[model samples]
Target: MDVPFDLNSYVRVLKLASTPSWEEFSRVALIAGAGVALVGLLGFVIFLLMSFVPGAGL
Candidate 1:
C-alpha cells in the first residue's frame, strides 16, 4: 500500500486562513481566560470539599 501527500490541499487551506483582528483576538482571549479560571475555581472547590471528608486523608 502507498499514500500520497496533497500539497495543493494544504496550500489552499493556508490561503483561506486569516489572523484574527485585535478586537476578535481580545474577545477570544477573554473568553478562553474566563473558561480556564472557571475550571480552576471548580477544581479548587472540589478539593476543599474533599478535604472535609472523614476518610479522604486530605
Candidate 2:
C-alpha cells in the first residue's frame, strides 16, 4: 500500500525553516568558531601531555 503525503505538514515545516538574519548568522558563527578553537586547543594539550608519558609512542 502506498502512503499518502501530508502537504499541510510539509507547508508547516517550510514555514518554520526561515532564513537566518545577518546578526543571527554572525552570532552562530562566532559561537561555532569558539567551540572549534577550544576543542583544538584541548587536543593539542593532550598531545603534549602524551609526549611526556613514559611509553605513549609519541
Candidate 3:
C-alpha cells in the first residue's frame, strides 16, 4: 500500500528552509563566538592549574 503525502507538512518544511536575514545571522554569529570564547577561556584556566601541579610537566 502507498503512503499518502501531507501538503500541510510539506508547506511547513518549505517555509522553514528559507535563508536567514542579516540581523538573525549576526545574532547567531555573536552567540556562537561568545560560546567559543568561553570554552577557550576555560581550557586556558585548566592548563594554568595543571602547570602548578608538581607531577604535571610544564
Candidate 4:
C-alpha cells in the first residue's frame, strides 16, 4: 500500500490567510456585496408596487 503525501499548497494558502491585509479586503468585499443586495431588493419591491397600481404604464 502506498499513500501520496504533499501539503505545500495548503501551507502556502494558510500563510497567506494569516495576513491582516487579506482580512481587511475580505471585510470590504462583504460590505460591498451586502450593499448591492440591498439595492437590488429595494428596486424589486418598487417594481412590484408599481405593477400593482392600476393604470400604471408597464
lDDT of 4: 0.82
Q: Report the lDDT of model 4 for residue 7.
A: 70
lDDT of 4 by residue, 16-48 (tens): 876459889899999999999999999999898
Task: Provide TM-scores for the models.
Answer: 0.83, 0.74, 0.66, 0.58
TM-score of 3: 0.66
What lDDT score goes with residue 41 in model 2?
100
> Between the candidate structures 2 and 4, which one is better when assessed by lDDT?
2
Regions of candidate 4 where Cα sits further than 4 Å from its true position:
1-20
Best by TM-score: 1
lDDT of candidate 1 over 8-42, digit per residue (tens): 77778999999999999999999999999999999
Model 2 clashing residue pairs (backbone): none
- Which pairs clash in the backbone of model 1? none
* Model 1 whole-model lDDT (C-alpha atoms): 0.88
The runs of at least 3 residues in candidate 3 whose Cα sits more than 4 Å from the true structure, single-residue gaps closed, are: 1-15, 56-58
Better by TM-score, candidate 3 or 1: 1
Query: In every candidate, how many clashes are there?
Result: 0, 0, 0, 0
| Candidate 1 stretches greater than 4 Å from native | 1-5
